[model samples]
Target: MSSPTPPPPREVLPWSRFGEAARELARTVADSGWMPDLVIAVARGGLVPAGAVAYALDVKAMGTMNVEFYTGVDQTLGEPLVLPPLLDTSALAGARVLVVDDVADSGRTLELVMQRLRAGERPPAQARSAVLYTKPRSVIEPDYTWHRTERWISFPWSALPPVTATATDGA
Candidate 1:
């Protein structure tokens, strides 16, 4: 029997591509007519897109939640964990809040973050999530998503182009 061919390397979604996606997402959120009291960015990947969205919406107050899932090469070995510096729910109480993230992979991160945000001493009744990309299999869907793809997205850093590598290496 012949063996099946292995899949090709994942395509790189560069910063410029992410920027375009973020812009589209920002426009969608802005046109929704739902003004958020604050923008809560899921740390690390979410920071850039959230900042762009906040700027587009003219939102001032920004907060972050740091959650770590993978620690280097062992992506599947660790239990998904939320890091310290819990969000100050007091600021979100009874207000509309927008939770922003780069990609909704398995939906676990967003779901857990939303749970934490809602489980606070004072929870916001109205909370929505926005993501730049959503995988087809994502369990929890964001209220707003800029793009959807069935294939896993390889970010810029993961698949550095020759030009990017040369620039970084000063070659």
Candidate 2:
């Protein structure tokens, strides 16, 4: 008989844990000696973490980039797609920008963001990217990373349990 293959291991990152990671990331960015003029978060996943970082650094201006890479159940075969109404490039001109994201999975999102920023008419004087968590084997590495793990992390919503109403019997 042929041996059966084992299922992939599951990794969970609770909301509290994620928050702690974000705080640590904020601390690292503060200690990096680079004061960003604006904070640009790669939207959706990056929004929460970026907000925390912005608060920690006391930065007022915040921007977001909405990019979609996944659509359905199958996680394979996807490319980064930038949503329209992008942040104004003029605001970033001659300013330091801190790009924030939640995790760097394949690094495609970060790579594309950098590319777009570089192509802008008025790019930032200096641009740095940060992430709460990063896969150690990621091709593109963030300037600042809070934690590194090998397991693939599934967001809470993705694994949420189904809701069901329970009936109570009274005596």
Candidate 1 residue pairs that clash: none
Cα lDDT for residue 78, model 2? 63
- Give a tens-digit lDDT track for model 1, residues 52-165: 888878898899988876444225424557888876788788988899987887777888888888888889879899998887777799999988876666765445434555
Per-residue lDDT of candidate 2, residues 19-68 (tens digit): 67777888898888888888999987788888888988889899998888
Top candidate when judged by lDDT against the true structure: 2
Candidate 2 clashing pairs, residues 3+ apart or interchain: none
Q: Which ten residues in a row have the lowest lDDT in candidate 2?
A: 69-78
Which ranges in model 1 have alpha carbons more than 4 Å from their true place?
A: 1-11, 72-74, 157-171
TM match of model 1 to true structure: 0.81
Clashes of 1: 0
